[model samples]
Target: MATLFDEPQKFPLAERLRPQTLAQYQGQAHLVGKNGVISKLLQSDKVPSMILWGPPGVGKTTLARLIGNHVKTPFFTLSAINSGVKEVRQVIEKAKTRAGSILFIDEIHRFNKAQQDALLGAVETGLITLIGATTENPSFEVISALQSRCQIYILQPLSPETLVEMLENAQKQDEWLKKLNIKLKETEALLNLSGGDARRLLNLFELVVSAFPANQDPLVITNEWVLSTAQQKTVRYDKTGEQHYDIVSAFIKSIRGSDPNAAVYWLARMIEGGEDPKFIARRLVISASEDIGNANPTALVIATNCFQAVTMVGYPEAEIILAQATTYLAASAKSNASYMSIKKAKELVRKKGDLPIPLHLRNAPTQLMREQGYGKGYQYAHDYPHNFSPQEYLPEAIAHTTLYDPGQNARENELRKRLKNLWQDKYGY
Candidate 1:
């Protein structure tokens, strides 16, 4: 077993154990099971452009490779981090001659608008089939035009059973592990550390095994042993990995929960971890409107200015601005009234689609529309007392619908009073 660790030096345990076939793959049964969408797609042999959206180390890259192999297509790989529009153009230029080629981009969300736009012509036309993998949500990260052309598949985290199976298999199948005769007495530490990532699970297993004596036959593994061995090895926070989302989640939840102390602490955690100042600033803007709203209108203003200020002043100075905004928002009066109002309004619109607008509320743009009684009985709010026209602006079918309910805060209480006095009993105020 002298070359046990040395043999797999080039290819890590995760890469070596990557699922070669759909049957060999663990987890995401909904996507690749007997009746899965991917199975059906493969049966028909009609592979379209797709974006695989999931967390890190969940076989996104592996699945992309498997798809290329199964379809017998020329597959090209690119990293959005180092590759830009120029590299993208080079791939496209080459893909022109090879029709039905597959171009897989790892961390596809990192591509900016211009870089994504470069792929539009090729994707729109059938020159190349794009397979984009990203950890971020495609709706927020990908350009709508490009996203519209690709089917998005979500890969879920590996289950505990699947993860355990993977570790056990790696130990038995690997030539080096067999030689070491490692005894896996317990796996709680490895599973907990993996955080449902299959690649991380295998990596942790390998690391723990390598630390033991070279000639130690029956190298026993246990929760306590693994934790102690790997604790000194692994980094607690990864800015580009799963820990990035966890810390940000804690930060946002602290703000929403109105704990300034926790909010500021989480903010420090982010800044220390090298998180993007703009990202923190953007969340601050969203939190202001979403959590504080009209309960403290100035909160939104402060957050907006914080975003602008951070954009201008980065790093050490930007941390100060972020902390200020985060604390102020956490301490402010909280309300989701405005956010809920829009959500309810959109839901109604979707459920009762294209509900005809009352002619009075509709704009009289042409003579024909005017003759059709558009704006015939429209009452201008400015012409009435208190600048409030007590007419139903919503369509007659959904008249008297109350969308905006003011929050029970000092500022919104005044708004509630004004609305109640104006609408009277008609709006149930």
Candidate 2:
């Protein structure tokens, strides 16, 4: 019954299929379903400042636009990459006139501290509602003060089922796509290549559909066709964008979780995405000390050497070295005893506020200082049997406080025994 002119006009499949309302939006049911938090918020008059943290193509931007449309309020968008403080101020100034206006910033993690600071007043004064979208962890990227003012909502990647439903919906809703006698032969290739990105699934699907002959009555979509078509188009991974952080996070977590296969795959993704070899090597070094720690001190040595080797070799050869280091670290026993110890120590320092060092533990460089009792009672371990002495190293205020708790590993278990022998009940080792 529909006329030819009523067919969906020329546009990217993703764009043409973008959900215009909450009812039309697919996936993210936990947030947008009938009883979802966002759905409840939409029912109210006041919309709070929030950050949408998720992977790419998960509809962060679309959700923001949909909220604006639902509220019937003025909506403005800016990219953190290109917008400076001046542009931000301009937007804020304009927002003042339009009460309850929403300002959406894409890739907001890229905004520096100063740039983020510019919006604090506007957000606090309720002049503009801030909606920030980021793929990076907001705790690392957003300043604490700003983060305190906004609610952070995490968006999940689309599942294969959701993605397949989206594809079906697109084919059903889009007139042009409906007209095409398209049959999906296998969905594995499409889903695997999309990596749970709905937009990518649609775009790749469109590309494959375009390859068919104009008059082909029944175009069958197969895994082979999707793979071949996708290969012909270079899929760029922006090393400086959201994908960069997502991939790196995956790489580090993979190592921490002891999955060498995953670690190598994520490492390859970074390498192919043109990530700096130094950056990759640096993370490996940190992981060595933070995750491997005393469980395998040799891990740090190997990681450090890998860094040096990668720096000297670079690129093609560096990847092999990285792979070796990644696999080794993933296979090694993991511990965060040292990492946790430092954190607890730092917290104690902040709480205690520079407690005075015990006089015996102080250095006596001059005769006058020695007369004042500096280093007067300090034990000389060399003079004692077994070159060990139980002495109060901590200040008088908190002398008995225990900081380091040896992790349950071969190396740390030995350390626990040695510490127990030296300190007795001073530390509950």
TM-score to native of every candidate shown = 0.83, 0.69
How far residue 38's Cα lies from its native spot in candidate 2, in Å, is 1.5
Scored by CA lDDT, what does every candidate get?
Answer: 0.87, 0.87
State the displacement of the C-alpha of residue 424, model 1, in Å, after optimal TM-score superposition.
Answer: 2.6
Tell me the lDDT of model 1 at 9. 61
Provide the global lDDT of candidate 2 against the true structure.
0.87
Model 2 poorest ten-residue lDDT run: 1-10
Q: Which residue pairs in model 2 clash with each other?
A: none
Q: Positional deviation of 408 in candidate 2, in angstroms?
A: 8.1
- Residue-level error in angstroms, candidate 1, position 222: 5.2
Residue range 221-308, candidate 2, lDDT tens digits:
9998788878844456677543565578889999999999999999998998888787789889999999999999999999999999
